[model samples]
Target: MHPENGLPENSPTTRVFVALAPPDPAKDELARALGPAYAAYPRMRWNRIEDWHLTLAFLGEQPVAAVDLLRAPLAELAASRAPLSFALTGGGHFDERVLWSGIEGDLEALQLLAEEVRALVREAGIAFPERRLRPHLTLARTRRDDPASVVEVAASLSGFAGTAWRAARLHLVASNFGRGPGPIRYRDVASWAFRDPAAGGHSR
Candidate 1:
């Protein structure tokens, strides 16, 4: 199934991703850090703090039955790696429509995670999207006419450095796209803990 957001019935319905979520304290810190920038671009759709996550892989719509099959590998992966710490820095837009914050620090770890997730998807026989890994946390969406504001907003956010937080859990979020003005509601369908580092690829 595809992710819950904007999917048709009878088709894969879940839009899935392997992600790193900030702890509560980090979320609070990010909200506090971004409050002013949020006001500067009043028209942009700023994502809610609770929905902030660093996505490692985006598994577009898939059949529901595959969720369990997908989870098994991710759980094993999580159990091996230690929680990663990363910092947010700068902002940019994708075709003037999507606004996102650049990620830094521990980037090697993030890259490794992406590679591991890609391998797992292949082993599961999932049709993986052909795209390079460009790590960034999407923060807002900009309207056409108001795109100029995002450019300035990105520059203003150039120095934002939120506190590093644990990446202890990987959430399988279900998104409801195209029907809400607020942040997409995400729920954990399954989770796996970090296994001992000595377990080869599974280790932190």
Candidate 2:
């Protein structure tokens, strides 16, 4: 959200996305597995545990009113679907600079859901860059000086296989990306249950 007159020039646009966060139990499980890497990769800028999430659609910046058109449609899409079963499996690096944990199980369903979200965004007249979905939880960022650290860390986690968990909520989130100097923080604009409570389905 932006306030005219009192905010920066770019305030009129907000950075937003659609995503799903793992429940505390699932996140905790991954955290435990990475305990050793935490100390070994001290220079890496680790993301806070609470901020971990898998983005379904990255809808960069847009007029706040344009996003409003998506509210009802997204809720309806989520309600028509059921929760997906997923597990954190292994690890990887992007350009050897970003470390992430992989996602597996129900992958076809996950891809279909993401495609639907992108389509809904288009229907709302929202435009965004198209990137192939590589499902993962971004764990940290490595520095240019020591790109090899992330590779070692990724190798160590190659055998990790976390317990399966249900993904039940679809969240529309806004991020404080260019607003100030600090770690990026995210807040949910709104969230909807994937399965409707009206027919014996519930949130996790």
Candidate 3:
């Protein structure tokens, strides 16, 4: 609400985050595996497969102008780093509510990348709460016994181990969350390919 006008203020801001998306094949495999769960747990708010991503830094809501300041720096950072290899292996639930699939492969490298990403966010003068990074793809959420059965669902995928794929890009995304919406949706603001030494550039 605009206090001065006593009306809604339409400030241009974006709910942005930095993340890495899984390749289509990897996501498809996991989707197939969850076919049964999709039927059995219809009540749980399952995330659209296209929306799955491993978030590194969530900058909450920032003025569009401020977010623009990050573009070139992130691109340069992407150019200096190489794509990472990862696999979707196993599953777990957060606090018996939110369901997620765990990550596998060089976690140390992933952690380092996440750290560097956060550092870059800080350097951008964006303020976000600091928290330890736990890499996972958010699969679904249950609001309490909206299905207390989430535990069973998580345990069911405990041994899921998908084949490995490279994390090829650095994605800056804007989300339509808490915007008087149905399911939240996301759109890519910009993405930069990781440096490929042989090509001397990224595919983006």
Q: Which has the higher TM-score value, candidate number 1 or candidate number 3?
A: 3
TM-score between model 2 and native: 0.88
RMSD of each: 4.0, 3.9, 5.3
TM match of model 1 to true structure: 0.83
lDDT of 2: 0.84
Residue pairs with clashing backbones, model 2: none
Where in model 2 is the C-alpha error above 4 Å? 1-10, 178-181, 196-204
Cα lDDT tens digits for candidate 2, 1-204: 334322124546677888988999999998998999998888888888988899999988776777667889999988888888899989999999999999998888889999999999988878898888889999988888999999999998899999999888998877777766555677777788888545775533
Ordered list by TM-score, greatest first: 3, 2, 1
Question: Which sections of candidate 3 miss by over 4 Å?
Answer: 1-11, 200-204
Task: Put down candidate 3 lDDT per residue, 109-166, tens digits, no spaces.
Answer: 8888888888888898988767778999999887675656678788889878999999
lDDT of 1 by residue, 15-71 (tens): 666677777886776677678877777777777777888887777666666756777
Task: Give the candidate number with the greatest TM-score.
Answer: 3
After superposition of all CA atoms, the RMSD between model 1 and the true structure is 4.0
Q: Give me the runs in candidate 1 sitting further than 4 Å from their true place.
A: 1-12, 178-183, 196-204
> What lDDT is obtained when candidate 3 is compared to the true structure?
0.84
Clashes of 1: 25
